[model samples]
Target: MHQLDPQMPPVLVFHGDADKLVSPRQALALRDRLLASGNRCELHLVPGGGHNFGQDVPAWQEKSRALLRDFLARQGLLP
Candidate 1:
């Protein structure tokens, strides 16, 4: 579907190394498809992380928030 159109809304994806529900490698595949069609996208691979980082530790949560804030700010998604 998206392959037929190059212009599309971008999505930011974060994958954990220990995610069991979804393969982290799938993120890369999605990224490749978006890239092939000249669509905007972002991907972040977190190490020592799992499917639920928010339930892991306070530090990880803070770090995740910080990264998200930075990305949004850079993309002008947040004012």
Candidate 2:
């Protein structure tokens, strides 16, 4: 892991529990590291989910979309 800047912007990370290409543990580790450095971070773990979530998008319904919107709004990326 690279050195994190405490003043860096907030980060949102999504990872699938069943992802084969990337380990979800890594995402958690990064989040922890960022938190330790006093950086804003959010981690969302999709249960029984894989790398691709196209099919699961519907399952997520509007919740994920709302979460993204809220995150963006917090960073002043949304009006």
Candidate number achieving the greatest TM-score relative to the actual structure:
2
Off by over 4 Å in 2: none
- Cα error, candidate 1, residue 29 (Å): 0.9
Against the true structure, candidate 2 has what lDDT? 0.82
* Ten residues in sequence with the least summed lDDT for candidate 2: 53-62
Error of 2 at 44 (Å): 0.6
Instruction: For residues 27-55, write the lDDT of model 2, one tens digit per residue.
Output: 99999999999999999888777787535
Pick the lDDT winner. 2
Every candidate's lDDT: 0.74, 0.82
Residue pairs with backbone atoms closer than 3 Å in model 1 (clashes)? none
Task: Give me candidate 1's TM-score against the actual structure.
Answer: 0.75
List candidate 1 stretches off by more than 4 Å.
1-4
lDDT for 28 (candidate 1): 82
Tens digit of lDDT per residue, candidate 1, span 1-79?
3453576776677777677778787878888888788877788777766787566434677777887888788879987
